[model samples]
Structure formats: C-alpha cells, structure tokens
Target chain A: MSLITPEFGLLFWQTLIFLLLLLLLAKFAWKPILGSLKEREDSIDNALKMAQQAKEEMQNLKAGNEKLLADARKERDQMLKEGQAMAAQFVEQAKTTASAEAGRITQQAREAIQQEKNAALAEVKNTAAQLSVDIAERLLRRELADPTAQQKLVDEYLKDVKLN
Target chain B: MKRLLTLLLCLCTFVGFAAEPAESGEKGGAFNPGEIILHHVADSHEWHWFSTDNGNFVTYLPIIAYQPGKGVAAFSSEKVAEGKTYGNFKLEDEKLVAIDGSKVYDFSITKNVAALAMSSLLLVFIFSSVAKSYRSRVGQAPSGLQSLLEPFIVFIRDEVGKKSIGPKYERYMPYLLTVFFFIWFNNLLGLTPGAANLSGNIAVTMALAVVTLLITLFSANKNYWGHIFAPPGVPWPLYIIMVPVELIGVLVKPFSLMIRLFANITAGHIIILSFISLIFIFRSAATGLISVPFGLFISLLELLVSILQAYIFTLLTAMYIGGAVEEHHHEEEHGHGEDFGTAEQRAGGSNVAHLNRPDVATH
Candidate 1:
C-alpha cells in the first residue's frame, strides 16, 4: 500500500482548513508562543553568561592554589635547610662537650697518682732514719761496758796520747 | 571563456543546420508526437531504428544501424509506393522535410500521473523514517535523523521565527517549519530523473506564494496597517502618493516570489536539456564528443543552483515577516518631537512675560 495517497478533494479541504487554522493561530496563539520563546532565549543567554563567570572564578581559584602550593614548598625547603644546619651545629657542640669532659677526667687521674707517689716516698725515708738512730745507740753501749780494761790501757795510752 | 566558446559552437551549429535542407529525401516520414514525447522522457539505451513491429513499414526516423560502415541509415516504410528506393531522400530546410509526405498529424503521449503518486509515497517513506527516529528518542538527546533535523529546526526557531516575529514567534514556528520543509523537499525531489516536471509547473509555486501572503497579512501588526494608510512623518502630498505604493508593495512581494522560483527552476531545466540536445543537432562525431563534457559541467552547476534557490526563497520570506511585525520607531520619534515643541512654547511665554515693559516699548 502506498503511504502518500493524496486524494484531491481531501487535500483541497485540508488545505483550506489548514489556512483558516493558520489565521486563527496567528491571531490567538502567536503572541503567547513568541513570549515563551523570548523567555527561553533570555534564560539561555543568562545561563551562558553565568557559566562563563563560574569558569573565570574557577581559573582564579586554580591560580591561587598554585601560588599557595609554591609558598608551602618554599617553606618546607627552608625548614629542611634550617634543620640540616641545626643538626650539623648540634653534632659539633656534642663533640666539643665530650672532648672537654674527657680531658678534665684525664687531668684529675694524673694529679691523684702524683699525690700517692709522694706519700709513699716520705714514709720510706722516715723508716730508714729510725733504723740508723737505733744502730748508733747500740754501738755506744758496748764501748761503755768494756771499762775494766780501760785502766791499764789508759796508762799506756796516756804516754802515747801526750801528743793528742 | 569556456562558456563563450560553447555558446559560439552552439550558434555555429545552429546556423549550419539551418543552411541545410530539411528534406534529406527520406520517404514516407513524418514527425509523430508520441515518438517525440517518448524520446524526450524515457531513458534511451542506444540509438536505433524506430519502427512499428511489422517489418514492412519504415519511417524517416534516422536509425543508428550500429554497424561498422553504416552507423546511420534512413529507412522507408513499405507504406510508400514500391519502386522508389532509399536514394529518394533529400534535404529542404532546417526541419526534416520529407518528400512524398502526404499526411500532416499532431498528437502527444499522455503522461502517467501514477509516477507523481509514487514520488509522493517516496517522500512520505523518507520523512516518516526521520519522524520515527524523533519519536523514539522521547526525552533523550536526539540521534540519527533527529540529530540532522534538530539543527535545522533550531535554526528556524532561533534565526527566522524568533528574530522575525519577536515576542509572538511560537505560533508561527509550525507554519514556518512546514513551508521550509515542503519547499526544500519538493526542490530536492525535482532534481531526480523524471521528477523535473512537477516543480516546473507554476501552480505549485503559486500555492506556496499564497501561503506566505496570507501569513504576512494575518500576522501584520498595527504599525503595518498604519504604514499602509497614513505612513507617519511623510508630507501630505507624499503620503497620498505613498499610500497606493505601499499597498501595491504588499501584493507585489509574493508575486515576485512566485515568479522568481518558477522561472529559475524552469530555466535551469531548459538549459540543461538544450545542452543535451546539442549532440543530436550537430550529427558530426567531433561536435558530439565536445558536448559530453559540457553537458556534465552544466548539470553540476544546476545542482548547486537548485539548493541555492530554495534557501533564497525561505530567507526572503522570513525577512518579509520581520518587516510586517516590527514596531515603528518613527512614532516614538514623533512623540519626542511633540514634547520638545511644548517645552519650547512654555519657555517662549515665560521669556515674553519677563521682557514685557510698556514704558520701554513706548520710548
């Protein structure tokens, strides 16, 4: 079956009715329809403008975020550099303190050893002096006890000793 | 330069043909309308000797015998008296003046209106497919045919109806869309083989132009009527002259539309046909060889023109609607002028009172 079966009489009537309907539409419906279209167009334009503004705002925020990130990175780098310098200074200070403590301990040990050596030498010297005194006394006593022989010897000695 | 050369060649060929006698002494031959119409309308496979199925009778229809030594031969019908052989042929004037041509007849082959019906069905099938796609999409985004049509629909809405009819554009959208599609579809169909005659008919164009006229008249605003009758700011004498002129302009606009479309489409068809007919006229192999390239070139140009004509018609119609519904800015200007005049009058009266002194005037 053909889709477009154009009946002449039918088409004529349809065309006439269509024309009349168009006239009616122009009279009654045109204004409201046009008004709605205008509103739609205006809304679309407004939407586009809003979208453009939002895009611009996003771009500005992106730029701000980039700058903040750069500043944060700079701060982190500065902190790292300062931390490295402080760590180096701390290590030097610790080494100086340890060396000073070691030197003081060694000096104190040397003084203590010298004091002990002096005490020991004085004690040895005192003992030797006592021993010598005792020995002299004993020899003198022996000589006194020998007096019996002394009389005879003295006569002979006096003659020889006249020169003393 | 090519086109000029072709024109010269055509003129030379026409003149040469005119110089030769029409009667190439072909016997029992006459021009038949049925043959002529059939020859023009149908697709010809090869040039052949056309004759009634009974072999005895022959006519002066130049038969391309399609043989090596005999490419073209004049055949005589048995209806002719028996002793005269093929040598009896002669040429008289530009037309094929047949010797012993005893009868004069005129007739035409009836065209099949069924073809037009078929064309309409084809149109419905194509558009229905597009329409079906649109319906299936429902609330979703348009795809396929809908995608193609949506832009054109939106273009009409945004560019033509909205911009032309202003606040009241919605009601006119349906009409505008119908007209644009109808005209464009018809124009495209007319480009197909055997379909050129429909658009060539003036009646079709007239009906379309009438629709445009009715829309403009009915949708016209108060400003449009005022401009037609009193036309603000024009002097009385000039206004009297302009009143009829503006009224006539209303009628003439649609009339011009009708003529422009009908003439352009018809003329293009005629020019293409005329170029194709050149091969038959020249009869020389060298001339026939040149016609092929030239005919193809002209056909290509016509294709571009066909689309262009449809666009121009639609665009102009939109412009006319824009003119009809647009508000008159001159009326506002007139009101401002009146206000300025009243202000000047008040100033003049105050100045006169301040300057009033009888004694000074008498002195």
Candidate 2:
C-alpha cells in the first residue's frame, strides 16, 4: 500500500532537481553542442556545393577550349587549301605563257622564210630577161653583115611602107 | 568453467550473508521474504548495504521535520536507531513521528533524495565537461566521453524529437534531453547493488509525468483544443459523451505514462528481490542454484528495462508535445470524416485513398 503512494517531500525534491537540471543543461550543455553540430553540417554542405560549382566551371572551360581548337583547325585547313589552289594556278599560268612565247617565235621564223623565197624568185626572173636581150642583139648584127642584102632589105621595106 | 564456478560461489556467499539477517532479525527464526523485499524496495532514512550476524552496514541520513506550531528541527537519523527516540520525536516504521500527538512534515534527506542529488551532480559534471569539449574542440571530431554520448544525444534529437515533434521540435529539446538522460542515468544507478530505488518511486515518476502534462497543456494549439472539445465531423448530440471522454483521454495519456514507468521499474526490483528471497525461504544452499541464476537474469533484464523505460517516457513526451503543437492541415480534416481514422492518418498518411473514395464515388 505504501509503495504505490506518493510522498510530498520526494515530489518536491524531484521537481526542484529536474527543473534545475533542465535549466542548467539548456544553458550550458545542449545549446553549445547542438549549435556546433548545425554549424558543422552547414560547413560541410557549403563545401560540397562549392565543389560542384567548380566542377561545372571546369567542364565549361574544357568545352570552350575544345571549340576554340576545332575553329583553329578549320582555319588552318582553309589556309592550306587556299595555298594549294594558288600554287596550282601559278603553274597553269606559267605553262600558258611559255606555250604562247614558243608559238610567236615559230610564226616569225616562217614569215622571214617566205620573204627570202619571194626575193630570190624575183632576182631569178630579172636575170633570165637580161640574158634573152643580149642573145637577140648578137643575132641581128650577124644578119646585116652583107651590105647589098641589107640595102635591098631597107629599100623593099621602104617601097612596101610607101605603097601601104 | 572454473572462473564461472567461482563467480557463482561468490554470488551464493553474498546471498547467504545478506539473507541470514532477514531470516533471524525481526521474525525470530522464521524468514519473511515479503517483508525483506518490501524494505529493500521502499525509501528509508538509512542506507543499508548488507547485514551480517556481527553487525549491519548502514549510513544514517539527516532528518528535517517541520511541526505546524513549532519551528523546523534538524538532526541525524542515528539518534533514533533500533526503536530509539530523539528529543520530541520517534521513528515509526522508518518514518518520523512526533510524540506530542502533533503532525510533522518530514523533509529529510531520504535515501531516494540523496541518490537523486548524486545522480544529478554526476549528470551536470559529465555534460558540462562534454559541453566544454565542444567549445575547446570546435570543428573537430568529438573524442573520449563526448564521442560516447554524442550518438545517444543525436538519436533523441533526430529519432525522438524530429520524428515526434516535427518542425517545431527544437523548442522542446532541452526538456526532452534533460528528462531522457536523467531517467536513463537514475535507472542505471538503481541497478547497482544496495543503491536506492529512486526512479521506481511513484513520487518521482509522478513529478516527471506532471511536467510532461504541463508542457503539453501549455503548448497545445487551437487545433488540439478544437479537436478535443468539438471533434470535427461528429454530430452535436454525441458531444455529451465525446467531450468528457476526450478530456479524460488528455489526462489519461500522462497518467498512463507515469504509472507505466513507475510499475516497470518497481516490478523489476520486486522480481529480483523475490528471486534472492527464494534461497532464504527454502533454507538450503542448493536453492542458490536456481535463485542466483534467476536473480542475475532479472537484474540484466532490469538493465535493459532501464534504458527502455527512459526511451519510452521521452518518446511519449515528444509525441504529446507534437500532438499539442501540430498545425491544422486540410488533409487531416478530410480524414477525420471517418470516425477512427486519426490514428490511421498518423500511421500511414493524412491522404489515405480510401478517405477520398466516398466523395469520388458519389461524384
């Protein structure tokens, strides 16, 4: 019977002790401990967030570098292709100019040969006419060697010219 | 095997020594196990460690009694040893009584009060040092005693506080932590041989329960009172019975909490004492074979019960606070349409599909 009953003295002490404990612990113990725990959690969370941000920034930087490298490669290829085309054009132009020079020289030589052949042909014709004139003059002189023949030839030529 | 036999022998030797005085002291040659067990479990002015034929090992506590007409008188309890009387007072069945037929209020430093003081001091020392460590070792891992108790503190915070009290749990943490460790430490202390049964006492448990009840009542929101006074969805005709029942339920929660812890710890002590009494009741050394092992087993069980009761008390306190301060949610109101779905709402969720089914089916 006594075991189940509550005593006033014990109750008073129990309540006093408990309330004091609650106050003391709340002020001195739990406040500091819980505050530190929350602070530690926040610090850790911040560290992880910063690490994630840094990783994203590194990825963006890498992507930008890759894009720049690709653009540089494309530009180099463009320059290389232009250089090759220019070299090809220079060779073609040089070949065309050499062919034109050769053609002009050959035409000039052919014109000079035609002119010499014409001059040579004219000289040969003039020499043949001169030789014929000299031969005729010698033949006339031999025929008039006889005077009476010559005079009768002159008189008959004269009577014929008068009768006409 | 040899060690174990020696330890058992030591236990038997202790039981034999402790039981003889109970058998021979007050009741002639006969042994009264009930009297012995009750004396051990009850509060007293003297701390009795053990008894032998030569003498008894005891510490007489201080007595402070206040008479209505007269002022307070303080003296050593040794002045009233073995049916003796002091100046105007006498010891009556380990209680202080006045000889002049007047009522005296005893505010002595009884066994339980002393034990409470010791345990509280110990708690303050341990926690203050731990608190200091937290200050000194900022941003570093807890070491030594700090490391050991940190897990339990976190468990009570996260598991008990956060889970029970929801978002506003921080406000009630100081009370929760203090009560948890106080109960736990005292429970463990009570398990020591010849120690005071401080936590098992009804007055101590009552004080704790009263604190919990007060906190719950003070922190209770409008929603909590609303649910109690006028339950949602209940017809007005049922309010006559429902209102009284709801009010009683509020009280019964704390009342049950008090009795549960008190009965558990007291029952553990009685069972252990009863087991030791078995050897004396039979008056044989062979009975020790059964009594010693059973007593040891119950003591170990009591160790577990100690922490378990502490956890339960704190958890229920947190739950009560949680219920009191919980904000009204529309989903919970919907669930209350079903008569007994509040518990189910708490268990599963506020949004049970079955709760919404009737409205949907009608539509």
Candidate 3:
C-alpha cells in the first residue's frame, strides 16, 4: 500500500519539470532533426524516380536503333535485287546486237562474191570469141596465099555486104 | 530463437520465484528489502549516494514550499536534515509540511527533479550538436553521436511514429521524440547506483501520461469525437451503452499508460533488490555465490527493460495520437475499408500490427 502512495510535493515538482523539459525539447531538438530527415527521404525518392525514367528512355532508344537497322537491311536487299536484274538485261541486249551485226556482214560478203563471179564469167566469154576470131583470121590468111583466092574472097565479102 | 526462449523461460521463473517473498513482505534481520527498495525508488529532498558504518553521504538540494499565509518560502533542504522543524515546518516522512497541519504546495528541487533537469540539459547538449551537424553536413552521411542516435531516432520516426501516427505524423514528432529519449534516458539513469527511479515514480509517470492525454484529446478532430459519441453504424439505442464505454476508454488509455511504465520499472527494481537481499538474509557471505549471479542476470535484464519500456511508452503515445487524429470517413465512404496510408503501409496487417500489438517480451 505504501508503495502506491503519492505525495503532493513530488507530483507538483515532476509535472513542472516534465512540462518545462517538453517545451524546451520541442523548440530546440525535434524541429531541425525531423526537417533534415524528411529532406533526405524526398531526395532519395526523387533520385529513384529519375533513374527509372532514364532506364525507360534507354529502352526506347535501343528499340529505335533496332528498327533503323531492320530498315537498312531491307533497303540493301532491294538495291541488290535491282542491280542483278539490270545486269541480266544488259547481257540480253549485248547478245542480240552482236547477232544482228554478224548477219549483215555475212549478207554483204555473199553479194560481193556474186558480183566477182559474174565479172569473171563475162571475161571468159570475151576471151573465147577473140580466140575463135584469131583462129579464123589465121585460116583465112593461109587460104588466101594465092591472088585469085584473095579476089574471090573479096568479091564474096563484097557480095555478102551488098546483100546485107 | 530457442535459445532466446530458454533465456526468457529462466527469466520468468526467476521473476515468479522472486515475486512470492517480495509480496509476502517478510523481514530478515534488521533489513527490510521492501523498505530499502521503496526508499531508493521514491523521490526525496536530498540525494543519498551511499552509507558507511559511521555516516551517510548525501547532497542537499533546495526546498521550495508555499504556505497559505506565508505566500512563498525557499530554503536549503539540509535545514531539516537532523529532523528539526524549520519555520513551523518539519520533514515528515521525507515530505515538507506545516506544523499547523494545513495545506502546503511543495515545488522543491528534489533528487528526481534535479535528475530530470540534468537529463533535459544533457538532451539539449547532445541533440543541439547533432542538429548543428545536420545543418552543416546536408546530404552527407552521419558522423559521431549523430550516427549512434540516428538509428534510434529513425526507428522512432519510421517504425513507431510514422507507421502508427500516419499522414500527420510530422506534427507530433517533437512530442514523440522528446518523450522517448526523456523516458529512455531517465530509465537508464534509474539503473545506475545512487540514482532515483524517476520513471518508476507514479507521480512522474502520471505527469508524462497527462501530457499524452492533453496532446491526444486536443489533436483529436471532430471525426474522432463523432466516432466516439455518435459512432457510425450502431443503432441509436446502442449509443447510450456505447458512448460511455468509449468515453471511459479515453481515460483508461492514458491511465494504463501511466501504470504500465510505473509498474514495470518499479517491479524490475524490486526484483533486482530482492535478489541482493537474499545474500544478506542467509547470514552467510557465501550465499553471495548464488545471489550475486542471479542479481547480475536480473540487472542485465533490467538494462534491456530500460530501453524496452521507453520504446513501449513512446509507441503507445504515438498510437493514442494516431487514433485521435486518424482520418476515416474518406475510407469508409469509398469502401476502402480500414486500410489507409500509402501503398507500402497499406499492406496486410500493417495497421493492426503497428497500432494494437504490444511487444511484452521484447528482449
């Protein structure tokens, strides 16, 4: 029972001192400490948020780079296909031109050969006639060795010319 | 964990074993363990350091008293050291009083008062320096005493203060921190030799409780009062029964707070003193072999209790404040249930875990 007893003097003094202590501490100690703590907390939260934002931005950039690479690959494939088609067309054009030119040269050579053969044939006919004429003149010269024969031939020739 | 449980089991066995003889109030030789413990724990006019065969070593403090007709009177407490009456006043059972048996108001600087003043000064000294470092070293890591105190300060702020007090925790931080360190430091000092059990004194605890009560009621908004007086869902007839219970609850909360701290600290002191008394009771110096070990173990346990009780006191204070200033209608209207606060704390059982539970066996 004595243990639970309360004295007025102790109560008064304890209340007075405790209230004074509370007032003093509330003014000086708690204000600054809590302020600094909250500031640090806010700053930490902000740093984490910024880091997350930066990570997302990096992911966006990586995706963009991949798309650009894919586009570039597609463009290169199209250009290669076009180049191959043009090369095939060039080969086809070259073959056709070469065959046409060869045909024209062959026809011209055949015409030239035909003309040369015709000229050679005409020269052969002329030679044969001259040879025959020479033969006949020689025969006549031999036969007209006598004067009477020459007169007879001349008269023959004259008579034939008059009749003509 | 098993180990801890065994230690706790041994502790409880020892405490239960100790409480028997203590409550029985038996006497051995000329020494009454109860008297020694009570005297040591109670507040007095002078500080008693120790006693020798020839004399007692004590330091006198100032005594301030007020009498109805005398207005105000101040003098050194030593004037009544020899049990002499001074100015029609004498020291009766360590209390200053008038010879006429009239009412007197005593505001003396007793031993506990001096201790309270000194501890407050110590707080100002330690924390003012810490506050200075906070200003100078913004965004940098803590150093020195600031580092040591930061964990506890942060623990109270985050675990106890913010978790329990919710969004408006900032407004109550000063009171919470002050009460925590004040109780904790006083409790630790009480464990030291030649120091009064400041927290063990009912008057001191009551003072602390009164402040808590004042803060809680004043901070309570209309919604809190509404919940108490008119309640939300109960039928009108139940309010007659419900309102009185709620009102009684308000008084019971702080009353329990006061008694909890006082009884715990006082019981610890009594148990430790009884263990020491066992040595002297057997009239054999050799009994010290057993008693001293037991005493030492209990003393070590007391060291843990010193911090635990302080934390419990502050945590309860925060909880009471939380109940008072808590915002509820928004949640009720939107069917958010009792879950409030942010995403982190809104997690399951957090509110109940923080607000309602007590860590009785904290060590």
Off by over 4 Å in 1: A1-164, B1-124, B138-143, B147-159, B162-167, B282-287, B330-363
For model 2, the superposed segments whose C-alpha errors exceed 4 Å read A70-164, B1-23, B26-28, B99-101, B332-363
lDDT, residue B249, candidate 2: 95
Model 3 chain A lowest lDDT segment of ten: A155-164
Clash totals in order: 17, 0, 0
**Location of the lowest summed lDDT over 10 successive residues in candidate 2 chain B:** B11-20
Which candidate ranks first by lDDT, i.e. highest?
2
TM-score of 2: 0.76
Give Cα distance to truth, residue A110, candidate 2, Å: 8.3
How displaced is residue B185 in candidate 1, in Å?
2.5
lDDT per residue as tens, model 2, A1-164: 77888887788879987888888899999999887776777788999999999999999999999999999999999999999999999999998898888888888888888888878877776665455445434544765888887677667655654664
Give DockQ for candidates 1 onward, in order: 0.02, 0.54, 0.42
**Where is the poorest 10-residue window by lDDT in model 1 chain B?**
B104-113
The DockQ for candidate 2, computed on C-alphas, is 0.54
Better of 1 and 3 by lDDT: 3
List model 3 lDDT by residue over A1-164, tens digit each.
53577667777767766676667667766777778877887799899999999999999999999999999999999999999998888888888888888888888888888888878877776776566557547757886788888778767765754674
- TM-scores of all predicted structures: 0.48, 0.76, 0.76
**Candidates 1 and 3: which is better by TM-score?**
3
Model 3, span B307-329: residue lDDT tens: 99999999999999988987664
Per-residue error (Å), model 1, residue B31: 5.8
Clashing residue pairs in candidate 2 are none
Residues A1-164, model 1: lDDT tens digits: 01112223223323443354344434333333334434555677898999999999999999999999999999999999999999999999999998988888888888778777777777765664454445434544554467665554555445544543
